[model samples]
Target: MNYMDDFPMLNKDIVYFDNGATTLKPKSVIKAMDDYYLNYSSNAHRGDYKISLKVNDAYEGVREKVKKLINAKSSNEIVFTSGSTDSLNMIVYGYFKNKLNKDDEVLVTKSEHASNILPWYELSNEMGININYIPLTENHTVTLDNVIKSITPKTKVISIAHVTNVIGDVRPIKEIIEYAHKNNILVVIDGAQSVGHIKVDVQDMDIDFLAFSAHKMLGPTGVGVLYGKYDLLNELIPTRYGGGMNISFTSKDEIEYKELPYKLEAGTQNIAGVIGLGAAIDYINNVGINNIEETCDSLKEYIISGLKSIPHIKVYNENVEGSIVTFNVKDVFAQDTAIYLDKYNICVRSGSHCAKKLEDELGIKNTCRISIYFYNTKEDADKLINALKNENILEESLGV
Candidate 1:
């Protein structure tokens, strides 16, 4: 099924293959945000006025929507933040800082995004915790056997991305989480690339903490979610302390904070973005997540099959699951390939893709990534292939 009509960006005469970065917002998501700004513009959960109450309802409604989207135990477990980076920071400092000890260890893969790995790096430096990598297979994907061999008695946390942004390898999270739990370790999932493309059931997977962005999943920018189990999330201290989260404050030493989700949501939120996120979730549910995954899976296969015929294009993640296809055009620098593709009105991402440590595993520092979404088509792949087939690619991209 064609989703061209739903996204206004499709009319711009460009092939959008940078879905891993951010997706084009659907009309429904746009309309929802517009309606919030145009119809009822007021501070939520403040003032007893009618519009304020309406704003309160709409803002809080998105929390429930997110809870259902991931099948969390309660809406109380959902905490809204700026984006995945913000959410990961909160999870690392707000929750783990106090719980973890100096000698404790945290396990992560080199392929994780900066959002997932850097925070742990900061925490490790500050708290004297050891950070270790779970060895990846030859395909640059994680295996359950490797996870077992990496863990030690001091391994208190296992944090990794559900689907790596660069290699597009979907980790064996369920098996990893189960093993971690048996060893009394907590599992934190960076779901920025996984939540939108695949079905995420927090309960079934027994995830301890999950972070994701709204913009990557067809919602507005400046909004994201941090999902934690009730007891665990309740223990997380508020990273940002401000109004809308406190019940009472006497002197410097006396203050009363609210419960569960509200305690974490300090200060005024991105109300319009939250409402748009609700609409995006609605749009995905209407189209069915399974259908979206199927479309990407099939399109990825078709594109990989065609790319193999081109000698210069060295495709990475060909055997990996999900929609992302990583490659480089032999002697051409990744960024030059990107610039050349832009001339053809086809867009693709080229770089370390915020996974700088990934170079250790992939054996290359830079690559061009074609991350597909449900909205991309076979025609888009054809255009990319045709452009790569040109022998003058190096000279043309270099403007020589």
Candidate 2:
């Protein structure tokens, strides 16, 4: 099936491969969000009228969609946030600040995105919790053996990406989560890269907390889901407080909060974005995630083979299962190479990709990344490969 028809932005002249940064929104998603503004646009849970009720129901309904998407136990476990960064911060400040002691250790990896790393770094600085990195394998994927070896008595939590944004290797999170639970260590997964591309069952994996952005999965920006176990979510101190989240303000000091998710989702939310997310989910479901995965896997294999034939291109990842390809052109700066590719109307990501610490692990300062989605075709891959095959194109494009 040609998905290019669904995304109006895709064309023969434009080969977009920067899906790891963000995905192009489908027309259905756009229309869903637009429908809200065109017909009924109101603050949810604040009004009693028909339009208000419609808004409220649509907003709350997305929670159910999200609950089903990740196979969460209940809708009460899904809390809407601005994005994965906001969700991770909420986990740190709301839960960890109160639960962890001064000497407690939280294990993370150098390959994690900044959203997953910085929150723990700040928490460590303020609360005196120790920040530890679980050693990564040579291919940059986390292993069960390393996680077991890294755990100490004080290790209270392990935060990692389900798929490293830079390396695109799917981490062995299910095994790690099972082991962490046995040792009483909470596991938090950053699913920004893995969620829409791969099937994730939070309950099946026994994941303690999972955070992901909707935009990365063909949904609207400024909207994301933070899934937590109901018991654990209730234990967290609500990070934000406002009108919608509280039940009563009897006195200046005495205020009663609502329930599990409302307490976390303070103030007005991205109602239209949430609705668009529901539509995006529908589009994904219709297309079938299994098919998407198979398509991307084949495309990745084809791209890797093509890149291997190019002598100047150095592919960074090995045994990579996902659709992302990170590499650098020999003697050419990553940004310059990306700019040269841009001259051919091929879009790709360059630089550290918000995983700055990964540079030391990969032994490089920056790389050019090609992140493919289902919309991308083998023809698109050929365009990129043929562009790189021209050895003098980089310098020619630079006018050097």
Candidate 3:
């Protein structure tokens, strides 16, 4: 019940509402990292020493945990990358390299984060494939109709975010996946926002690929997961190659690469981060993701309602449903609001939040975003609302 008790950072009396950006790690996750460094901190899968074996086992164990977390068919389907951006780039490059031609198209939605959008944009430019955009509804939600309208015979891939980071709108992923499958188009989901907050089943959803970051889910940074079907993953060429990924090498003419996940994971892997992510997964399991979802959503509803009551404030994506509440006070800059909130030990995010295209489309320069996680309480929401209500921007800025 007392989730905050498990996070050392929460004890500082700071109201942390920036879960969409990254979550504060739990004590168990921190301890997991500490234990790794203290005990078996060795290069994984390289040497025959006992420490190497232990470290390798610990690193591989996180793959199993991730497999279970997303209900993937096998651990081999998961590839470790630097972060969601790395994973997205890998998917875009590896999957589309030989398949796409000059006239081919890659469909992506406007709601996509920059990580998801830019990689494909670059790929399309390099490969001479036309990049097609799926228009968002007036409410900024992507619908099946838009998918249907966007996909043509030349469409080879459809990439979109599972959840829109700006509006907090959950896309109809299953339906989109089904449509893509019917059209023989690969579906790559930017699961960076969705994985930690919602239940994800790669098999059930029939998604070709999904990308997520560990840091957003109470895990360490520099660790990300890319889940693809085993056969598809095998078909994807290695975007990066080096030590620990090759099975054998003979002179300058011959080389044999390792298996699925390892082939994608080049160089020395993030062993400690992966281990900490495993612990974070275990922590989420104990807390029950469903319960976390309900708790955060309840808090979001409460906060958004309170924000709406403020006359001069305009809440972006008020109709969208999720744990993020984006708004701006009248005659106040978004960054100024964030700065003022920081004085009360409140942490919130401002600006375009890495979705430059979405912000441009909406004509919003920036918006203050309050993102909640399972650890946030209704009391925290109350504090945020009360702080906003009590503060006068003119007075605060001028010391009047």
Candidate 4:
């Protein structure tokens, strides 16, 4: 079956360019979730009943799927969380609570999404660790030189986004990871915007920890993967504790915890969501991530060229090689531009996009961002540009 054809929202006339925020799910994913609720909707890893066993197996299968998706060393390294935000927080709080001390530093960049930055900031505040910013170049890409200069003996962790959500600049994670590891610093990557859009090999990159949301890859929301090195994960403690993650409990003394992934995942998981994520991974594997990347690259090129041809428009990070295009048109407010484009059945994201610090660093209040996925085509790009060209006329006539 054609994967794009299975998306319910694609049948509508609206052009979807806000894929960075979330993606529309395919029918297979929906069917997978439906099958769970209809047939074997039981709590996972808690009961030995047949339905519960089936749920447990299906839920655990997703761990293997995610490990393969990112080329992780083992399925035991993958932990399920609510989403990227939860995963990042878990790692930050769990690791830093024991690892960092007063005057110790956590290095990050100005281009990070709030999900990656805020958790580290809060950790630093509570633990008395110093948060240091790795400065970006004029083109908005982080350089190894800046990273090298920022690192001091006190730096214990280097947390960064694999790709900037606002500018779409991909980070040099391999180089950064190698550099950090040489200095005995741990690297945590926020992969929320990078995982589905490009090929990611956590083992090859030697990333200590990484987090990505499944919904961004056309899976269900409230489901995400956190991949950590086996040895490192074995050493860290769980930020969340409850059923399904513990080994044994004593009334008077300490409780032993389960190993690796189970130790990190507490309570009842979103079994249906995990099953749907496995299906989504199957769909992506069939389509091929390289093919998806190339398709979006072509669409991004088309969008950047078209937007540049329009008068009084400034595209952010024009040279960056990613599927997103962020820009501001003339004197129009980013929200106003998005509102005007809505009349043409065009959908785009506007405002700070949860990267307020990055926006402030760039000295822009807001921008309109058009993020494309593999299913998008040149026709969508044309519609966006045409609508943008006629935005003023549409706005004036509508008395806006």
Candidate 5:
């Protein structure tokens, strides 16, 4: 039951709790990438020989793996990109920028990550579109009723995170997507924090588009997936063009593009990383995602219960679900608290966490964030709590 053994980094004298930022890669994922470089190292689609064929199979095979992971209607619907930020930009600039017009509205929440918020802001600025906010409930959860009330005739799209990275509120995305569809609005979900942790089905929810990162899901970094409906992807003009994406070119004036998936992939991709993502998915499937989810939930509950006993720690997301806990120690800077914990070899994220605009919403300048995965144990949480309980030690770092 010790999933920690799968991760080579866990062998060190460290407790990695910064999973929300990025997860520790498992040995299976590492071996998958290593096997590619050690055995068949070649570019995909551009070669016809033996090594090239293996690369092509791996490149295309990962697409199918992502399709099954999110339950997309077709393997063609999944497109590989650099990461979630890259995927969201593709949606905003490739699709929405061309489709939307002046005065059109895109509904989003203020609690969204910078990747989700900045792209929409640029779209609105350039296209003369409007970016609107959907009000959160009293507990900061994105409820369906609030979404219903936020809709207007000018609303063309609704973009939000499946789970907010800072607060860890699991939004009612399925119901929101259904409501948006009824109103003829497109829904773009930022699934960076939700996909690997929870069971996500794009087809069952009828999601128009979903973006997630590989590094957050026990996979290698520098790789991500962008899932879209077939018809909608067709409407998106490929932003990057050159190399393998073009089918034929007669001078600069005439060119024919490849089909879906390939058309979006401009150049040689991160072949090793994509292959590693397939291995990560295989590892998750073997362990069972449901089992992982249940384990993480139990650990989060235990951590929250232990944190409550400490009077100095102010815990946010206490009522929210998921494995992320955001809190601050009384009279201690978030970064300083993190440094104190680091002395004990407990790793956590501290800062605005790339969501700078979240300050006004949460009424705090910064927070210490602890995110757990299946590899974590009760001892890890106990060490963190014991560290916080040592006021004499923590106060020393206050001047830091």
Candidate 6:
């Protein structure tokens, strides 16, 4: 598929390998948002006019699309939020905070993004719960053995990323979820990196809670989804309160809150972002998620092989499978390598990548990450390889 025509940014003179941060927006998603603003710019559930009615339909319609995207049980299972960070915060503070007692443990990994870790950290401090780590294998990948070993009698919840943003290793989520269920533990999956690149079926996995951002999957920013089972999700207290989430309220302690998702979402909401997310789902369905994953895997293998052939290039996570390749130019700082690559019109991410503790596992604090999407071609790989092959990379990066 010719994705260059669809993504406006691709036509520019640059190779983007930062999909883990966010994917490029497709034209269809942009057009949908534009149409929403130009045609029906009305607040949802607040008016009975024609455009407002249309806004409600488009807004709620995206909920159904999200439900089908993840094979969720019902549309009510999806609650829109600001982003994956907001969704995870809701899961941690809104639900788990009230459920866990003092000294209860929640399992997470070092490779998890900060959004997944920090919320749990705050919850642990407030509730006196222990935050535990699921040991990663020598390859920095989680195994069922490690998960089993990490779970103790006090372990009430297992919170982890379906795919680690730092290493891009796809965790054995199904096996882990199955084992956790057997031990009567609820699982919270951070699907920010996985949902956009791979197939995720909440029903098949029996996931307790799932969170992901639309921007990472070719949709606009400021829109995300928090998916939970109907019964468990309803148990979550509304972290925020306002209009559109209640039916009636009075000074005499007479307040009736809405149910399920509406109870969780209590504001004007991001109407344009929601419509764009629906369009993004439509685009993904047309291209096929499996096809996108396969393309990324093939490209990743090729890129890794090319980088490995360069003597000065040290590739990390080379054995790990996924759309990301982490490496460093020997004797050059990670950010310096990123700056040098920018000289060649290539884009890559550097630094700790929001997984600060991953340094304990890697024994290195920083590495350049190349997170690919389906749109990236082998030519992008060639450009990056050639740039690494050039002489005086250290001096050039140092501006000497």
Count of clashes, each model: 0, 0, 0, 0, 0, 0
What's each prediction's TM-score?
0.99, 0.98, 0.97, 0.97, 0.98, 0.99
RMSD after Cα superposition, model 2: 1.1
- Cα lDDT tens digits, model 2, 253-304, are 9989999899998888889999999999999898888988998889999999
lDDT of all predictions = 0.93, 0.92, 0.88, 0.87, 0.90, 0.93
Candidate 2, clashing residue pairs?
A: none
TM-score of candidate 3 versus the correct structure, residues matched by position: 0.97
For candidate 4, what is the lDDT? Answer: 0.87
Candidate 1 scores a C-alpha RMSD against the true structure in Å of 0.9
lDDT of 6 by residue, 1-400 (tens): 5798999999999999999999999999999999999999999988879999999999999999999999998999999999899999999989998899999999999998999999989888887999999989999999999999999999999999999988999998999999999999999999999996899999998999999999999999999999999999999999999988988889659989998889999978999999999999999998999999999999999999998889998888999999999999888999999998988889999999999989999999999999999899999989988898976887888755
lDDT of 5 by residue, 1-400 (tens): 4566788888898888999999998888999999999999999987879999999999889888999999998998999998999999999999999999999999999789999999988887787999988987666678899899999999999999998888888888999999899999999999999988999999998999899999999998899998999999988899899888899999888899999988998988889999999998988888788988998999999999999999989998899998899999988889989998888899989999888877777889799999988889898899888888877656666556
lDDT of 3: 0.88
lDDT of 4 at 246: 93
Could you tell me which 10 consecutive residues in candidate 5 have the lowest summed lDDT? 391-400
**Backbone clash total, candidate 2:** 0
Q: Using alpha carbons, what is the TM-score of model 2?
A: 0.98
Give the Å error, residue 192, model 4: 0.5
The runs of at least 3 residues in candidate 3 whose Cα sits more than 4 Å from the true structure, single-residue gaps closed, are: 394-400
Across residues 1-400, which tens digit of lDDT does each residue of candidate 1 receive?
Answer: 3478889999899999999999999999999999989999989878799999999999999999999999999999999999999999999999999899999999999999999988998998898999999999999999999999999999999999999999998888999999999999999999999997999999999999999999999999999999999999999999999998999999879999999899999998999999999999998898899998999999999999999999988998898998899999989999999999999999999999999999998889999999998999899989999999998887898766
- Model 2, C-alpha of 244: deviation from truth (Å): 0.6
Report how far off residue 142 is in candidate 4 (Å): 1.0
| Every model: Cα RMSD to truth | 0.9, 1.1, 1.4, 1.5, 1.2, 0.9
